[model samples]
Each structure stands twice: as structure tokens, then as C-alpha cells.
Target: MRTLLIKNAKNIITMDKDRNAYPGGSLYAVDQQIVAIGNDIPYQAADTVIDATGKIVYPGLINTHHHLYQNLTRNIPFVQKTELFDWLITLYDIWRCLRPEDIYLSAKVGLGELLKSGCTTAADHFYCFPNGVSGELIDEEIRAAGELGIRFFPTRGSMSLGRSKGGLPPDEVCQTEGAIMRDSRRLIETYHDPGRFAMVRVGVAPCSPFSITADLLRESASLARSYGVRMHTHLAETKDEDAYCLERLGMRPLEFMEANGWVGPDVWYAHGIYFDDGEIGRLAHRGCGVAHCPCSNMKMGSGVMPIVKMLQAGVSVGLGVDGSASNDGSNMLGEVRAAHLLHNLMHGTTDIGAEDCLRVATMRSAKVLGWADDIGSLEIGKAADLFMIDSRQLAFAGALHNDATLPVLAGLSQTVDTTIVSGKVVVKEGRLVGVDEEKLARMAQAASNRLLNEASLRTKIDYGRMRANRAYPNF
Candidate 1:
């Protein structure tokens, strides 16, 4: 079996039960499982040995929610100022033109960014399938993640309600319920690994309440439970969503979802910013989790999530960068920092600390993805998934007093010095291990340009022009 060893870390922040941290720590892994972790590890010889002299080791940050395909559609001038509903209508045309190559390249660019920023595991919600494209788009992204050596938990997301049926997406982009179920079954059967230390797992997601019918939500939840895989979707993200659900379904977002049996430990909602105190209690009672998207919420003006209250109420709260179009980037470390600062601003300084934000990004995020037993923290028998940053950098010169909180509290230098996933060094010296970063960026940008040009031609809108005040397209 292949072996890997890291020795003499400046500090190792283990997000374990007691929240133990070791100064001058050493970790040893046999193959993909961590075997020893402490201030002193006896055996040092291994196929790989890293002398992390001045580096702070952390449990690799987990991204509980993402739209990897949105990496190609970021910074659109027209939709930058729009809210969630208008943003969906404006971008549906562009997203419905996604090709398999675009998904592959976008995943590479996005996941590569996550890797350099210290995220080892990511869960992507890919829901937009272009009309008449029979290609396996989720498979393309899974391939990209495998090539990058990042642990992946991808949900087979489906949008079944169209504008003709009062949904946000155009009719052409929405799939039939039969088609969605068929593909969901196929993806889970083919890729869902129910074992511990799995590199890839599949989930079932029906995009959101406003984008899917009530019948589809129940069917999707039942199907996910039938396979024992997890369920994920966008829920309670915006006031617009709340308005839509209450107007159409005659109930609040959480109420409607719970009616469809969409609340449980195996289910997680993205951007749960609008849940009230009573709804938060119900969520905790049902053991449901929330993936908090701080940057995306602030950018979309959605509103701040009650993360401080959720944590206090025994809710499993985690961090997500959301879609790159919404967050405009896939930097997990940046997400953690933004979450810390945003919570401090909304709540008080004493409400949530920097280490608490890190915990949300690491351990709690893993729980959201249903991988808490295997890959959340640094411990014996857990997967060897972690990242290290050089705390001796000039950016962290005066801020290394508490290594557990240094990552969230430090400024500027967010890129990690090294990243190892599944006992394999996937990034070294703040760069991807086997990826041609320059080439990937060039190709991804070319893909983005092509999609935008096509979208502009199709819609007769100048997407390249600066139109900060322009009214967005109505689907």
C-alpha cells in the first residue's frame, strides 16, 4: 500500500469531538486512511514525507453546495445587480446552451480553484441540461473531479417546471419527470458508493421549490430514500422564493418542503437564509442540515442566514460558495473568511468566532454531505484529506497566535501551500498537482466567451457591454 507522512507542523487543528489541536504535530497515513495523528508519530518512512515546519495543517474545507457549471458564467454585467428570480430568468438562456465540453472545463477551472484554496471535497448541483443534448453532463464533471483528485459528491439535479408551467426556467430547459427519474436512477446505480472513504457519491436533487412541482419533490425525495443516497436542493434562499411558494403552494417554503417529506438527516438545503425561528426549530427537530452561502447571499441581496441561531439550536450548519455565477468565484477559504466576517457583522463579535466558522466549513460541511463518519476531521481511521498553509508567510506574520482560527482570521494570502486528498498530494506550492492551470484558464475563458456570444446572438442582447442599469430579460 502507498504511504504518506507529514511531520512537524507548526500547528494541526483537528476538528474532533473535544476540538483538540496539536502544536508541532505529525500525521501518518497508510494508503488513503489516516493511521496516526499527534505531536509525535513513531514511524516516519513513507513513499512521501512532508516536513511542514512552519505550516498550519487543517482538515480540508468541505464545500457542501456548488454549481460548478456557473464558473463559466460569472461577472455578467446584466445579472450582477438582479435578485434570485430575475437572475434565473436572465441566465437560463445562457445555461441552457451548456455543452459537455463546457461542463468539463468549468469543473476543472472551479474545482482547481477550490483545490488551490484548500477545499478537498466538493458537492456540485448540476441541473441545467440543454434541450436535445443527450450527453452525460454530470459524468463530465465527475471525470474532471477525478482527474483533479478531489473527493466529489454530485447530485443529479433536475428542473421539471418551465415558464409555461409558472416556473422560472424556459420550457426547453425543463426535463420531464420520467426523464429526470430515469437519469437519477442510472447515475446513482452507476456512481453512488455507499461505503466509507468513497471518492465519489451521487445524490438526487430537484432544483428548487419554485422550479419544480410538488409532485416531483415528493417523488424525488422518495427516490433518494429508496437508494439510500442523500437529497439536496435550493430552499428558503430568498424572499422571492418564499413569495412564490406561498402564492403558488399556499404554504411557506419549509412548510411545503416538509409536507413533501423533504426534511431529515439525509437532506440538505442550500442558502437557507429565510427560515424563521419556528422553521429553524423544526429543521433541528427533523435533523435536517443547511448549507450557508454567505457571499452569494450578500451578492444577491438575499439576506443573511440565521446561522448563529441555527448552530445554537442544534442545527447542522455548513458553508457553501454556491454557484460561481452567484459567488463569482470558488474559493472555499474565502467563503470561510466571508462567513466569519459576515456573521460578526450581522450578529455580534461574541456570537460566532473564527474557529466556529472553520468548523462549519470543515466538519459541519462534511456532515451536510453525509460524509461525517469518514472525511470531516483529522483523526485515526479517517480519510487522509487535509490541506496545509505556510503560516510563516508575510501575510500571516503577525496573525499566527491561534492556528486553529488563523485561516479564517488571516488576511490576503488564502491559497494553501499544499493540499492532499485521499493520501495523494493533489496540490503543491499553491498549484494543482497534474493540471495545466494556464491552459485550463485559457480554454475555460474561450468556452465562456463562446457561450456568451451565442447567448447574445440568440437573445439580441449585448452581454459584453456594461449595462449596470439594464432591465433583465423576462423568461
Candidate 2:
């Protein structure tokens, strides 16, 4: 194993127990684990060293929720102005044309953008499996993550309910419960690694309460627990979801989830916007996590999630960019700025500051993904995953001394100068280490165009007409 030392950092914000920030900090690591960190850490000579002078380092940002496949369909004029149900209904027709190569290319673009913006780890929910798309699609995404060297939690997400079953998704996109469980077990047995600092871990996610049957939910939770993996799904994203639950299943969103054995620390939900006071309390009590997607919620016009109240009640809240189609981008730094500004506007106060946003993005996100013991904080014995920024940039001109707050308050979606994942510097000088980003862009654009053409022909919907109107600009 090779030992690497990072010395003379201008600032290292350790999001640890005491929330310490060290100036002129030095970090030492061997292989994948951090061995030491401080102003002056005494140790033997290393095989490699990175001089991080004039740079501010932090624990790499953790994104707890995403749909990497949706990166192929962002900014579609067809569904730009719709809410949750309408958006899903419209997009399901388009998403039914998914392909394996599309998943790989989309994962590269999404995870590549994430790494450039200082995100080291991310949890993706890949649920939509169209009719003709086959052959271990989740494995395709895992392969992409491996190539990119990003720590990944790729859940075997499923959708079972269809229009025939009184669900929003079309029948073509939904799956059989038997098939979902079979694949979930196979993925767990094949890919899951429960040890600390693992590169890839698997989870079983049954899309949502309205999309899947009651049996799948219980079985998924039980199966995930039996293997020590995690569970994830979308919940309480909007009032429409609440109404559907109350009308169809005769329970609130959280109540439906709890009834199906999905309330625990091992479980986390995406876009928890419409949860009530009691539900938040129960989530806190049960140690359940919430992956807050502020950008998507605002774009979909969903109500602001009560993040302050959730924190007050001790709920573990993390950051997520959500689906690329909804968020229209996959940059975690931009998500931080949106969370900081959006919450302030929603709360009408300075109660939740930039520090709080930064904390949730790093430390709390790690908790949400069940990695608090392994990653997140910059500490000894943790995974050596972090990012460094030259804070003397134009965006942070006047905020040099307050480097910690500038990430959220400055509102710049700038790329990091360097990002280190698992003791490897995967990004340097605001560019990927070995990736051909231009090739990825060209390939992704070609794949997206093919998908849109096929899907539009199948659905017979005229996005061109929608763009013709002033409501949507470019299709």
C-alpha cells in the first residue's frame, strides 16, 4: 500500500464532533483510510505527497439521492411545467425507451459532474425498467461508477404499479413483484459489501407507496435488513402524493410507509416535502433519514420541506439533487446554494445559516446513506475522500477568511480545483483526471436524441408544439 501526505492546506474544515477548522492543516493517508490530520501530524515519509497550499479542503460532499439515468432527459420541453404526478405521467412515456448504453453514458455524465463539483459519494435510485431494456442495468451503472472511481450506493429500485393498477406510471414501465425481488436478492448477493470504505453497496428500493404493492414494500425492507443493506424510495414529495395515498390506500404517506415496515435508520426517502409535524417526529424517533432535494422541489413547485423543524426534531437530513430531469442538473455545489437560499426564503429568517447547509451536505448526508462511521467527516481512520478549492477565486474574492461559509453563501456553481476520492485525486485543476468529458458529452447527446426520437414516435406527443408556444423555449 502507498502512503500519501497532503500538506500545507490553507484550511481544512473537519466536520467532526466539535466542527473544527484548521489552518495550515496536513492530512496523511495510507491506501484508502486517513491516518492523521492536524496542523502538524508527525509520521514517516510517504510515497507520494500533494502540496495543497492556497487551497481549502473539506470532507467530500455526499449526495443521498439521484436518478442517474434521468441525466439523458433533462430540460425536456414536454414536461417542463408539470408537477409531480403530471411530470411522472408525461416522462414515463419517454423513459420507456431506456437502453443499457444510455444508463452507462448518463451515469458517467451525472457522476462526472458530481465529482467535478466536489461530490465523492452518491446514492442513485434506478427504478424505471422499460419493456425491451434488459440485462443487468443496475450493473451497467455500477460499471460506470467503477470507471469513474466514485463511491456509489446503487439501489435496485423498482416500480410495480401501473395505470392498470391505478398508478400514475404506464403499464410498460412497471415490473412484476417476483422479478423485482429476484433481482434485488441477486444484486445483494452479487454486489453488496458491508465493510467500511467499500466502493459499492447495494440497496432494495420499491419505488414508492403508490407505485408498488404492499407485499413488495415489506419484503424489500425485510430482505434489505437480512443482508445489512439499506432501503430507499420517494415519499411525501407533494400534496398530490398525499391525496393519492389518502384516497387509494386510506393512509397518509408516512403512515402507509410505516405500515409496510419501512420506518428505521436503514431506510431513507427522497424529496420529503409534505411531511407533517407528527411524521417528522416519528421519522426522528425511528432514526429515518430524509434526502432533501430543494432544486427539484422548487422546479416542480412542490412545497418547501420543513428542514429546520426536521433538524429540531433530530431527523437526519441529507442533500440530493434528485432526478436530473427534475433538477435539470447534477451539481452538488449548486444544490447547496439552492438549499441555503431557498430555505431562507421559505422560513423568512436567518435561523438556518450557510454552516447548517454545509453540515447537512457533508456530515448529515453521510448519515442518511449509512456511512457516518466510514466516511463524511475529515477524521483519522475514515475514508480519505475530500475536495479542495482555491478560495482566492473570483467567486470568493471578499470571502477568503470565511471559506467555510462561502460555498453556500456565495452562490457560485463553480468546480473544485481538486477532488480526492478514497485517497485518489480524481479531479485536478477543475477537470477530470483521466476522463474525456467532451467525448462523454458528444455520446450522451447522440443517445439522448435517439431516445427522444423513439419515445416521441411511440407517445405521439408534440414537444415541438409545446415549444412553439411561449411557455417552453427550446425542445
Candidate 3:
């Protein structure tokens, strides 16, 4: 058996039932589980010891929504000004050109960034599975997450309706309902583990209401509930999306989703910016969760999610960095800070305080991912997944008194000093263990260049210089 001990931290921001914060904290664990907490934890022997002096400990952040493959497409100059629908249309072309190797490399690069930002578990919504691509692309992501030592919840995302069927994506990028359901079941059977501290859990996601048929939505929900797994998708993200749903489905986004049986504890929607008071109450009453992607929302001009209202109504709300293409990075700590600022501007106060943002990122996020019982808080009998930042640094000089809330409001965005996941130190001294960081960065950029080249993408402004020799496509 393996034993690990973390001793004498500056603070432990435990997002437990009591909302506890411990100073001069310590934690003890054996194998993958946390055995005890605090200075009085009984211990006889130890295989390893992590001296966390001058460091602030936190429950490993959980990212409830992401498009990990989009790490390769970050800041593609042209799409910077585009909004939700146009962004999807533009990226779908490039995404459909992806090979299995691209998926693997992008997932690794994205998950690596996330891990460095103190994210231990991430749920990647990968919906773009190009035709004739052999082997499970999601399997590539699973393999990459294992290599990087980050817990993963990769949804079998599907797009069934194409432009031909009044949807956002092209036909070639969409799949048949039968194929989507078949693969969703296979992935859940092959990878979804319902046990505590599960590293890999799969979900069934039919992309979104506008991207899939009503039949596919209802059936996907049934299939996921049948197998006891969660369901996820983007919903009501923007005014354009609201118009699309109302015009096409003859109902508001939430009504259409409710008609399709997409309410209840097992379902969580990404964005969720357009829901009203009645809808918010409905979500809270039904126990459905929301993955609030504030950075992506601001970047793409998507409306602000009513996180204050959601919390007031007792809805389960968590934070997500969204697709790296929209967010431009995978930093959960940054996401928390953005949430703090966004809500402050919207509601005009500290109604959504720093402690609240930390809870949203950790405790509520674990619940949103359906892993609440095991890995959210720093407590005994939980998974030993956490990150530490050296409070001795200048960033936390004055904010040290409010360590639990400081991470969200301190405006500090450096990588954590160390990160431990499942009783193993995956990141030590602010670097990933056993991984070549510089080499990975170079390789990822090379892969991105190859992908853009293969997709025939070029700068948008090159066409206006009377340069018909280079035809740049606008999406």
C-alpha cells in the first residue's frame, strides 16, 4: 500500500458542509483516498511527505464544461470578433478536418494547461467526429488524460442535425442518430465508472437542441438515464440562439428542453444565460445544474448568466472555461476571477463573493459533474485531489488573511506551486511531473499549424489586398 502525507499548510480552504477553513493544516492519505485531516490526524508510517509550508491548499478545481480539442484553435485571429453561431460555423470546418492524432495531442495540451491551473477533473464536450475517422477519437482524449494524470469526464457529444436539416453545422460534420446513440452506449459501457473517486466517467450529449433533432434529444436522455450516467449540452447561450430555438422549435430554449425531458438532477446545461425567473425556479426545483462559462460568454458576447439568481434559488451552479477557442485558455483560477468580476459588474456588489466563486469552482463543480460524494472538499474519506499555492509570494501578501476567498479576488494568475491528484503528486514545484513542457508546447503549435493548413485556413484580411492568389474562407 502507498502512503502520502501533506503537512503544515498556510491554510486549507475546505469547501465542506460547514464551509470550514483551517489554518496550519495537514492531510494524510493512503493509496487514492484521504484518510484524515488537521493536525491531529493519526499516522504511524509514511511512504512520502510533501512539506506544504507557506502554501495555501485548496480542493482541486473542477471544470464542468470544455471543448479540449479547441486548444489547438485558440486566438485564430479572424474568429476573435465573431459571436456564438458564426464562431461555431467557422470552427466546424476546421474541426471536421481533425485526425485522431490531433485529438490526442490537443487533449494533452489542453488538459496540461488545465492541470497547471489547479484543475484536477475536467469534462470535455467533444462533439466533432469527422466522417471516416477510424478509432474512437474520445479514446485518444482518455489516453491523453491518463498521461497527464487529470481526472476526465469526456462526453460522447453528437451533432445530428445539419444545415440541410436547419442546424448550425454542415452535413459532413453531423452523424446519424443511430450512430450517436450506439457510440454513446459503447463509451459509457467501456469507460463510465459509477464508483467513488472514478477517474474517467462518460456522458451522453447530443450537442445541443439547435444542433440535434428532437428525437435524438429525447432518446439520448433516456439512454443516459437508463445506464445511470449524466447528460450535458449547451443551452440558451445567446440572443441569436434564443431566436433560433423560438423560430425553429416554436418554444423558448428552456421550454423546448423541458419538452424533451432534459430536466432533473442528472442533467446540466452549459451557458444557460437566457433563462428567466420562472425557468431559474424550475431548474432549482428539479435539481438540474448549470455550468456557467463566464469568460467564453464575455469573449463571444454571449449574455451574462444570472448566477446570483441561480444561487438564490438553490440551483447547482459551477464554473467552466468553455472551449479554449472561445476562452483562449484553460485556466480554472482565471475563470473564477472572471466570474467574480462579471457578477460584480452585473449585480453591482459582492453578492457573488470570493468564497462563493471558490465554492462554485470546487464543491458545486464536483456536484455538477456528479462526483459530489467523493472529491469536492478537503475532508476525510475523500479523494486526495488538491492544489497548493505558496502564500509567501507577493501576490498573497495582504490577502493572506482571506486565503479561502483570495484566489478568486486576488487577481493572481500564476500556476500553482504543486498539484496532487489521487494521492500522487502530478505537479511539483509548479511543473508537471515527468513531462517535457517546452517540447509539448512546440509539438502542439506544430500540430495546430498542420491542422489549419490542412483545412485551407488563411488570414481573413489577405483577401482584401487584391490577393485572389490566396483564397481565405470566411465562416
Best by lDDT: 1
Encode model 1's per-residue lDDT on 10-98: one tens digit a residue.
98899998899989999999999999999767877999999999988999999999999999999988787788888888899898788
| Model 1 clashing-pair count | 0
Candidate 2 wrongly placed segments (more than 4 Å): 411-413, 468-475
lDDT of 3 by residue, 267-360 (tens): 9999989999999999999999999999999998888998999999999998899999999999999999899888889997758787888889
Q: Rate the local accuracy (lDDT) of all candidates.
A: 0.90, 0.89, 0.87
* Residue 45 lDDT, candidate 3, scale 0-100: 56
Worst 10 residues of 2 by lDDT: 463-472
Indicate the residue-level lDDT of 203 in model 3: 92
Error of 3 at 4 (Å): 1.0
In TM-score terms, which candidate is top? Answer: 1
How close to the true structure is residue 437 of candidate 3, measured as C-alpha lDDT?
91
Q: How accurate is candidate 2 locally (lDDT)?
A: 0.89
